[model samples]
Target: MTPIVVPVPGVFPYEQLGFTNCVRHGDVLYLSGVASLDAQGQVIGDDIDAQTVQTYENIGRILAAGGSSLDRILQMTSFVVDLGRNGGGYVATRARILKQPTYTSAVIGVSALMMTGLLVEVQCCAAVSN
Candidate 1:
């Protein structure tokens, strides 16, 4: 089957950034790294706790737009820029967002992210009912 590009809206015009928010093929959906930015593409959260919340909120919207949801996630990978400095807060925030029966996920530490103030970027794969 031909892959359907899910029109998952991002905080900014994603096409200009050389990416689509999410794409769906068959029953699977793949998402780009979701960030903690607001509609104007401004970084909303400085700390890990605040950033994680905003990042996941962005991911939730993308998943929904892709005809899926967080619970259907098969795997998730988070890129953390300040893991060494803010690792605890990142883990705690992630734990709060991902409750019981959480999906499989991995966190990778990076020296820096694309954005200066960004602490985390979350991407995932999920099964879409549609």
Candidate 2:
């Protein structure tokens, strides 16, 4: 099956970056790692809690654009710069944001990401209606 790239308006500068925010194939939608980036593509948060919320907000937008919702998410993989310091806040923020609490998830510790000052980055796989 041919995969279709998903676009979320004013979210990420995917065109300049040479990548799509999300892609759909068959019944699944795969999202790229979402960071705490504003419409101008600058990192937005100084701490983990704020970054976690922003990351998920970005994820929500991508999912919506891809014909999926947060509740339809099947799995999430979050990469964090300081898991030990921020993992709890990340988990708490996620719980607060997700109404269904049904998706499988993981939080991984990383030394750094593509951008500096990025506390967390979230990627998801979700079910999209055919």
Candidate 3:
């Protein structure tokens, strides 16, 4: 099947990355891993709480462009630089933003991410109804 790419105006067409924000194949929408970059592509905040919020917001925008919404998200995967230090805040943030608690998800702790100041990254998979 031909993939349909969704470009959130300021987020996609990453010149150096060569990838879009999200791509749709059949009924599934595969979203790229999103960081805490704002509309201008700069890291938004200093801590995980702030970064998580911005990351989720970025995911929301990409999902909308993919013809879906946060409610349609079937699965989510979160990556954090330090889980022992920041896991609670990340879970709280997810609970606050996602109105319903029906999606499947996983959180992982890693040594580092692509950007120095970034503390969190979120990636999601959504199912589009036909």
Measured with C-alpha atoms, the lDDT of residue 77 in candidate 3 is 92
In candidate 1, list every pair of residues with a backbone clash. Answer: none
Candidate 1 C-alpha lDDT tens digits along 1-130: 9988887665554677888778898899998888898877889978899999998888888888878887788888889986788777888988887775557878899988887899999889989865
* lDDT tens digits, residue span 30-51, model 2: 9888899998989988988888
Query: lDDT score, residue 14, model 3?
Result: 51
Let me know the TM-score candidate 3 reaches against the reference structure.
Answer: 0.91
The digit string of per-residue lDDT tens for model 3 on 1-130 reads: 9998766775634546777678999888998789998766788999888988888888877877777888899998999888999989989987888979878999999889887888898888998755
For candidate 1, give the lDDT of residue 106. Answer: 85
TM per candidate comes to: 0.91, 0.93, 0.91
What's the CA error at residue 100 for candidate 1, in Å?
Answer: 2.6
Q: What are the lDDT scores of the predictions, listed in order?
A: 0.83, 0.87, 0.83
- Native-to-model Cα distance after best TM-score fit, residue 63 in candidate 1, in Å: 0.7
TM-score of model 2 vs. true structure: 0.93
Q: What is the C-alpha RMSD of each candidate to the true structure, in Å?
A: 1.5, 1.3, 1.6
Model 2 regions lying over 4 Å from their true place: none
Candidate 1 lDDT at 79 equals: 91
